[model samples]
Target: MAINIRNAVIQNVTGNSREELEDTIVDAVQSGEELMLPGLGVLFEIIWQNASENDKKEMLQRLAGGLAK
Candidate 1:
C-alpha cells in the first residue's frame, strides 16, 4: 500500500549552498566537536611551513597557551 505523506525532516536543503555548509561548520565548531580540528590544523601547518622563524615562535607560543588548558 502507498504510505500517507507525513511530517518529514530535511537534513540539507537543495536551496542551501556552500554558505549554508560554512554556517553549519561554524556552528559545529562552537559546539566543541574536535572532528573539525584536523582540517584547521592542516591549514595552519601549510601556513607555518612558509612562515618566518619569528612567526613559528609566535605560533608555538599560541599553541602552548591553547594546550595549557
Candidate 2:
C-alpha cells in the first residue's frame, strides 16, 4: 500500500499553535534525520501555495543567498 506523505504530515499538525509548529520544525531540523525532509517539504509547499508573490520572491532570494554561503 502507498501512503500520502503530505496528507499525513498535515494531519499530524492539524491543530498546532504557531509556537508548536515552530518547535516541531526546529526539532525536526535539529535532529538531522532524513525522514524529516519530506515533512519539511510538505510544509514548504503549503507556505508557497499561500504566500504572496513578493513573499515568494523573498524566499527564493534567501534560498539563493544561503546556497551561496
Candidate 3:
C-alpha cells in the first residue's frame, strides 16, 4: 500500500483554527527539526494553491530574497 504523507499531514491538522495553526507552525520552526519539513511543505502547497497571482509573486520574491541572503 502506498502512503500519502502530504494527505496524512493535512488530515492530521484538519479543522485547526488559525491561531492553532499558527502555533503549530511556530513550534515546528522553533524546534528546527527536519521531521516537520514535510508538514510545512504541505501547508505551503495549500497556501500556494489558494493564493492570487500577486500573492504568489510576492511569496516567490520573498523566498528568493531570503535564499539570496
Candidate 4:
C-alpha cells in the first residue's frame, strides 16, 4: 500500500500550536535526518500555498541568498 506522506504529515500536526510547530521544525532541521525532509517539504508546501505574493517573494529571496552562501 502506498501511503500519502503529505497527508500523514498534515494529520500528525493538525492541532499543533505555533510554538509546538516551531519546535517540530527546529528539531527536524537540527537532527539532519533525511527522513525528516518529506515532512518539512509538506510544511513548506502549506506555507507556500497560504502565503501572500510578498511573502512568497521574500521566501524566494531568502532561499536564493541562502543557496548563494
> Per TM-score, what order, best first?
4, 2, 3, 1
For candidate 2, write residues 3-50 as lDDT tens digits: 999999999999999999999999999999999999999999999999
Native RMSD of candidate 1 (Å): 11.8
Give each model a TM-score: 0.47, 0.98, 0.91, 0.98
Name the weakest run of 10 consecutive residues (lDDT summed) in model 3: 3-12
lDDT of 4 by residue, 1-69 (tens): 999999999999999999999999999999999999999999999999999999999999999999999
Q: Give me the candidate number with maximum lDDT.
A: 4
The collision pairs in model 1 are: none
Tell me how many clashing residue pairs each candidate has: 0, 0, 0, 0
| Model 4 TM | 0.98
lDDT against the true structure, per candidate, is 0.61, 0.98, 0.95, 0.99
Which of the two candidates, 2 or 4, achieves a greater lDDT against the reference?
Answer: 4
Q: How do the candidates rank by lDDT, highest first?
A: 4, 2, 3, 1
Considering summed lDDT, which 10 consecutive residues are worst modelled in model 4? 5-14
lDDT of 4 at 21: 98
Instruction: Estimate candidate 1's alpha-carbon lDDT, on a 0 to 1 scale.
Output: 0.61
